[model samples]
Structures are given as structure tokens and as C-alpha cells.
Target: MTSFSYGEFAYVYDELMKDVPYDRWVEYAARKLQENGLSAPSILDIGCGTGEVSVRLAKAGYDVTGVDLSDDMLTVAQDKAQGEGVQLSLFQQDMSQLELPSSFDCAVIFCDSLNYLETEDQVKGTFKSVYDHLEPGGLLLFDVHSLYKVNHVFGENTFTYNEEELSYIWSCFQGEHPNSVEHDLTFFVYDERKDAYDRFDELHKQRTYSVDTYKQWLTEAGFSKVETTADFTSDSPTDKAERILFCVQK
Candidate 1:
């Protein structure tokens, strides 16, 4: 199967994601920074698809830099930042091999972006890279799909979305690895000029490990403190939690 790249998918991403709570993510980052005695900290937004969260952080008066693996997505992000009248430094880079000239006070990987990494080594490499780029007392915040979600919610499931301009049929199958899912999506977008629909297909793979595994990786990467929360709240995750959030300090 071909790997997923946000090529044409970048154009419809924002429209499909209108209900995402981007403001809440920014607020969480800001509040965490303030609680840690960091005011107006510089932020590194890893896997910042379409710049939604990055632009919001900039508007919230934080220095924001965005990184993504897809050039098409970064192009959309650049346009969005300009339209929103926000300044953002954006780059196309793999999260596991991150490299930048300056360090940041906080690094965030939101929207379950960390789940896209398909291997244990990639995830560990990403933690090490983020740790290298953080300043002393810096914070690293990220979220991922819980193991239960990967196994029960996405495994061998089918979903569909219908709209006037766009529609998609999404099917999920078990991946080769444990606790992993491979999503096969077929999209049909209306072509108003041609009075027809154009179709495309994409394949995406996502995997999740347990909280203990992630914490061990953070410790191996030299993080000083680590905390976990569930579904955007400050409570510890239960077995049924769909999302798991991690807050680590360097």
C-alpha cells in the first residue's frame, strides 16, 4: 500500500475539520506555559497540519513555528497564516529528524498527530529530537490515540461523510503490527466547472502504544517530569479513554 501524503487532501482539510477545538488546544498550551512560569514563550508546533493551531497560538501572542512532512500541507498553512494576518515560520520537515537553528520554550504535537508514526524507533527518535530542541525547563505537550481507540474504534470499521462539494468513504483494517490500523479512504470532490466529480484514494496507517511505553521513552530521552491526562481533561486516563495526552518537561 502507498503511504498517505496530504497532496490534494490538503485543500479540503480545513473544511472537513471545522468542528475541531483548535482554540482549546492553544488555551491548554498557554495555560500550561503560564503555570510553569513561562510568559509569552516560543512554541514549536510539530505536525502542524494547515496551520490551524499555529495561527491561533500566534494570535494568542506566542512565538509560533510550524513543521510538517507534506509540502502541500505547508503551502496551505502558509496561505492560511497570511489570510489570518498572523506571522508563522513554517518548514517541511519530518518530526523524527527535526532540525532548527533556535530552541523553543514549548513544543506541541496535537490532533493525535503522534499516532501517525508507525514504528517504535520513530517515536523514540521524535522524543529525542524534541528534547534536543527545547530550552532548559522547556515543555513538550502532545496527544495520541489510546490503545482502546486503535483496537476497538478504528479496527475493521467503515465510515462515511457526505457533503455538497465533497464526500468520502473511509474503511479501516487491521495493520500488520499490534494495536495498529490502516485507513483506506476514497474521496469524491465536485468539480463545479466540469459538472462532475473527481475521485482519489489515500491510505494512512496509525498505531498506538500504552502509556507506560510512552513514559519510558520520555525517560530514556532525558525528560525530567512526565504527566498524563485523558480526553483534554486533567484526570488520569482510564482504560476506555479514547485519547491520551502527555505533558513532559526538559
Candidate 2:
């Protein structure tokens, strides 16, 4: 079994994530862009897993380019875009070492993807790379798991999901680093032709820092202004907020 996440998991990603509010994310990005005087701007969808948000943004008339480290995820994203009759420039690349050809009007790393960076330096590098690839005055929008969620929600927790075609046992444990968690997922998927269930496992790790630390890093990476919100709303982040969203201007 592959230890890395998003390998075999990519096949079942969309099915398991059907409840995700992809439209809300797209709306938020569009609203922020319009507020910044960018209408129908070019967008870079960093860590665009399976292209769910990327396809939606393209359908909403934004020029979208998606980049992800996983080839399987990118394959799924490309197929999704083709099925939606939308054109997306998809690339396989690491987010921390991004090197695209053209600058973008806006860049986004949503869905707690930033938390996947285990080290502080990697997160800072991602911010700087994004800053370099964005045009002057361009905005960078991203989100991460709050410290509260990492400690209280995911720490040493076990969750199970069941459906007719799929089931999973997910266990989370405290990682070696502060504000980090390791996820061990065991999946049993129904195979129709074989009339049997195939079992596989994957391990994923995520880490996050305090909001102030993130803000300081963004400033260090050349962002002039950084505004934050909580749980997809415009309200300020409270201690109990689960998701912390950041919008920075370069």
C-alpha cells in the first residue's frame, strides 16, 4: 500500500467529498476578486485536488490554471475539466517550489491544503513562490485548519464513514511536531465485477500554526496587507473557529 495520500484515494476523492461546499469557495474567491477590481481575471489554483474548485471557477468565466503535486489527482482534474467542457491549464508541480510560466491575477490554496505543509519553512516558501507568481496588487486567498481544530477535533480521534459502495475507518493521532496530526485511513471499496471488497490504506499528515504567525510570514513574503476571516464568513477568527481563512495582497 502507498503511504502517501491522494494516490489510490484520488479515485474515490470526489465521491467522498460530495458534501464539500465548492460553490461557496468559488463565490468567495469571485467576490474577493471583484472587490479588488479584478473582474474575469486569471487565477492560479494551487493544490487544486481533482479540480473541483478549478472547474467551477472556469465555468464561472475565470481563466484558471491548476497545479498539484499528485499525478493521479491531476489526471482526475483533467478528466473532470474535459467532462465539464471547460479548458484548464493543469500542471504537475509542488506548491512549495512553484515555477509557472506566467503571472496570475489571483492565486488560491483552499481546502486546508496549506496545512499539508509540515514545516514552517515549506509554508513560508509557498507564500514567497505565490508572491513571485502573482502580478502586482494581485490577491492570494487560502485557508488552513485552526489550532483548535487540530488539537480538539482531529487529535487522537477516530471517525468512520459508511455507504453502499464504500466505507472507511479514519484514525488521527498527534504528530511529532506541535499543532500537527497524522491520519491513518483504511478503506474498503466495493468492486462490482469482482463482487468483492478491496481494502487499501493511506497515511496523511497535516500541520498548522497560529494566525499571528501566518500573518507575520505573509508580511515577510512581501504581502502588503493581510485580512483574515473564520469559517468561510467575513467575521474575525475566534478562538473556537475551525477554519481560518486568509486574504493577502501582494
Q: How many steric overlaps are in each model, in order?
A: 0, 0
What TM-score does prediction 2 earn? Answer: 0.97
TM-score: which candidate is best?
2
* Candidate 1 Cα lDDT to native: 0.92
Give a tens-digit lDDT track for model 1, residues 1-250.
Answer: 2333578889988887898998878878887898899997999999999999999999888899999998999999999999999999998999999989899999999999999998999999999999999999999999999999999988789999999999989999999999999989988888899998888889889999999999999999999899999988989999999999888999
lDDT of 2 at 103: 99
Question: What is the alpha-carbon lDDT of model 2 when measured against the actual structure?
Answer: 0.93
Q: Summarize candidate 2's per-residue lDDT along 46-78 as a digit string, tens digits.
A: 999999999999999999999999999999999
Flag regions of model 2 displaced more than 4 Å: 1-5
- Which 10 successive residues of model 1 have the least lDDT summed? 1-10
Q: Which pairs of residues have clashing backbones in candidate 2? A: none
Give me the candidate number with maximum lDDT.
Answer: 2
lDDT of each: 0.92, 0.93
Q: Which ten residues in a row have the lowest lDDT in candidate 2?
A: 1-10
